[model samples]
Target: MTGSVTVAGLGPGDAALVTPEVTQALSRATDVLGYVPYVARITPRDGLRLHPSDNREELARATHALEIAAAGGHAVIVSSGDPGVFAMASALFEALETWPGDRHPEIAILPGITAMLAAAARAGAPLGHDFCAINLSDNLKPFALVENRLRMAARGDFAMAFYNPRSKSRPHQFARVLDILREECGGDRLILFARAVTTPDEAIAVTTLAEATPEMADMRTVVLVGNSATRRVGRWVYTPRSAESAAG
Candidate 1:
């Protein structure tokens, strides 16, 4: 039997949030490959093999999963959130571009609940209107590109969700990001700092751009900035579904 490769999302560190489809895929996988923390989430089974690697080794992990699948071993590559959202699915396809074979192994991409959606839900519909998700890490892309996108998103009056907002290595970048947001969206715009949503250590903070500090975010946090119309009602923060004209 020809082997197949599946890229699955584990869903934001919560087993309860993992979809039935991903659970079924894991049950049938002979070999599982992913970042060390993500691989650790899978339970050991008699016939299963788990290969865990460092966070920066995405391309290598994807290639190894493809090689295993091509050799008639059922392989699954796991990612933290939805595989297509800045995760392994794109890396796998990049590896497939250089894969040498008469016929490639069958591949599948299974989606999971992404971090932004979970964070938004926890914050009471802050993303109720149109929004854009941005990955703030400049590891693969240029900082200039990220700045340009942020400016355009704010200019279009779109709410924004940011992933990988801060890390020890890139500490000052998020500060600069906050500066840009403050310039574009002004100091009164509301921003939410959500860390480890749906987990035991989860914390959510809602504050304005002026009140939001760079220290408020870390690599584990997902940052959300509300548009012009976003506001708070009682204990909840949300953007209305309808658009209001400037004349009104």
Candidate 2:
């Protein structure tokens, strides 16, 4: 078999949102690898093998998938949300950078609906204008960098979506994030907390920066902060598409 490695996204917790392209890749996979929860989403079959690992083993998982593919097996690596966005695709390429093997197996990255986009949709076009996505985890980068990016994005009046906003381990950082937003964007700016988007337990709340609390968000939440011009009409929150809307 001509071996291939396909990195696929499972999308935010909804089966319906998983792309057909990713589904096709999984159906043909001889070996599959991913974080435990993501791997669990895949159905087990007679000829398929699932390699589930802890969150910290991304590089190892990617290398193993490559090895399997190079040996003429169809390997599929899964990730929640798009693999290219803070997921397994980057790790797979990082392994390829130092790959000692002469033969490079075919590699492909398949996209899926990410949590930020799902959350944005739930809140109705909050990202209609210019926006930026930021990962607030600080696992691979410094917290100062996160702070700087938050400040710059807010100061530039761009709509923003945040991933990995708050967790039990670092519960207090999100408080600082809220404070920074208040300083840069003022108290009346719109902020949204969308949790478990597209899943049965999904909850979405839109509030002002002044009323927003850190406890409202968790690891499962995707937070959205609207630009200065973002507002609510009836019940929907959205940013006006015109540049003049910001100045008006």
User: Whose TM-score is greatest here?
Assistant: 1
C-alpha RMSD of each candidate structure in angstroms: 1.5, 1.5
What is each predicted model's overall lDDT from 0 to 1?
A: 0.93, 0.92
Residue 244's lDDT in candidate 1? 76
For model 2 the local lDDT of residue 222 reads: 94
lDDT of 1 by residue, 90-113 (tens): 999999998887788999999998
**1-248 in candidate 2: lDDT tens per residue?**
58999999999989999998999999999999999988999999999999999997999998998899888999999999999988899999999998899888999999989888998888899999989999999888999999999988987788999999998889899999999999999999999999999989999999999999999999889999999889998888998888773431
- For each candidate in turn, the TM-score is 0.97, 0.96
| Best of the candidates, lDDT | 1
Residue 142 shift from truth in candidate 2, angstroms: 0.5
